[model samples]
Target: MPTPNKPDFQPVLIVAGPTASGKSALALDMANTFDGVVINADSMQVYKELRVLSARPDDGELARAPHRLYGVLSGAEACSAGKWREMAMAEIAECHAKGKLPIITGGTGMYLNALTAGIAPIPDVPMRIRETVTAELAEMGHVAFFDKLKRDDPETAAKLDGNNTQRMIRAAEVFAHTGRGLASWHNEPVLTPPENMFFKKLCYMPPRDILYDRCNRRFDLMIAQGALDEVRDLIALNLPPTAPVMKAVGVRELSSYLSGTTDLETARDLSQRETRRYAKRQLTWFRHQMTDKEIIDTQYSESLADKLRHDINQFLLTTPK
Candidate 1:
């Protein structure tokens, strides 16, 4: 097969959708066609510990194309969007220099948004503050964490999701360090958009029923594929419960069950429910963060890849400068 003409301008192929919507397959197909490299955009995919659960590209897929940043982070490290953007910028520039397309795909909107449009310069929270807040969150849970934040800075609490512990801690950490809520800093100004003409955005959404089905089945599959043991190993490390990976849907549920705090069925149910909620958040993010992209429906997904191929070709043929 002949290669497509090298795009004269930077053209990033951003393939994003809810989980299990064939985003990876579409991205791989496009990479093969355009001699592209697939960069890890999913937050969980960054950790080397979650190979199957995070759905990192399989052996055959990685053999076919070079994938950057997948399974590279230690599970213990807190990987912020700022860190991801730094790594991805280097990878993207390398791909551009080599005249290869950089195909970016993931469900993590914060990471995607950070790269496509530039992010505000947020300082890293001090380790002492992180440990302190993480410990407090463990003892008090998110409710108390929210109460503390509301007392410390009511404005940040008003804007934040009470249950989002990860972000909540980050916000509190920022305040503890700079004495200013991140919300105020965010209103400062724009630096650049995530993409620089190089990105051709392709957004997709599976219907609610389909997405829920995927989330449920994937939960079962995770159990079948040793997700329990993975959590077992994680817990054995004696890391704090507040560690990000320790809170991943299946991990938390299974860890609870293993610790005899809950039964297996209840754990599985809660995992499925939380995963569905995560999917909903992803859908909302895509709908709001990006405007220029085309949205593809995967309700009738029997022809998903074919439809995606057609869309890419069509977009390539007609999209203007």
Candidate 2:
């Protein structure tokens, strides 16, 4: 049955799950039944050039309702929670103005968290400082980075990996901006429960074995659908190796195949393995970080929609705006 809208409230519904776990389908079904806008929250699907590999919704699916923020970012630029938050906040404001429910769906936990609790301001590092850090990291290895961060902030150093250059740079940027470590900056109080908005957050997790099967099958399907060709075209641009999109899992594997470092089948297997690892990480994040949210175990599918409908209906007439 279709939902009947209430004028007094517009709740933001966020559906999150691991990749290829029917999040897009569920969001589409909700959009069809309710006057809602489907907003993309996945990190990779935002890139304009990555539609095929990112598993973005197809034209037929998008035609069902208004969708926003998909395929908007250029492939070269680094897209992060900060930029996503800026775009999402604007879209949310517009959705509210138009009196439509906003359904933010994705596998990216950081993006969803940024939507509710505003991200701690992130700033760009000075070019000189960044290059110097990168050079030092290259020459001395993570040991050098670890030593620097340890001297700078023992707490952040304790929690971080020396090999994670992006995170290391981010901590440095935070320190450079706020004169404190990223840990200290995060200590600042966050005023959340965003204005005039309430959310019913749900994470859809099927069993581990089933989820792994789906991941492998979906990745194979992606390869068959010209994901390799997509990467071929993307690499034709000859963007810097450090360009943001090149770092994505499948892209690197595809590049190895293109470079003759690995056979296509080997590359595909490697990609699938990495994707499974990523899904495992996402599952862990869902369990630990969102322990309080209502989680649907769609392992067997017998209770899937009943649980889904019950959860949605529970929020419909009762959750405060």
For all candidates in order, the CA lDDT equals 0.79, 0.78
Per-residue lDDT of 21-68 in model 1, one digit per residue for the tens? Answer: 768877888898777899989988898777767878889999999999
TM-score of 1: 0.81
Query: What TM-score would each prediction reach against the true structure?
Result: 0.81, 0.85
Looking at model 2, the pairs that clash are none
Instruction: Return the lDDT, model 1, position 84.
Output: 86
The pairs that clash in candidate 1 are 10-198, 11-198, 12-198, 12-199, 115-194, 116-193, 116-194, 116-195, 117-193, 117-194
Q: State which candidate has the highest TM-score.
A: 2
Local error of candidate 1 at 307, Å?
Answer: 5.7
Q: Report the C-alpha lDDT of model 2 over 1-321, residue by residue, as the tens digit.
A: 223355546578888888877788888777776678999999889988888878999999989999999999887666778778888878877887786778899988988887776676655344445555556667877777678778888888788877788888777656655578888767766535466577888788888888889889988999888898899999998766655677666999988998899999999899989988998999999888763477867653536756666777778667653
**What's the true lDDT of residue 54 in model 2?**
86
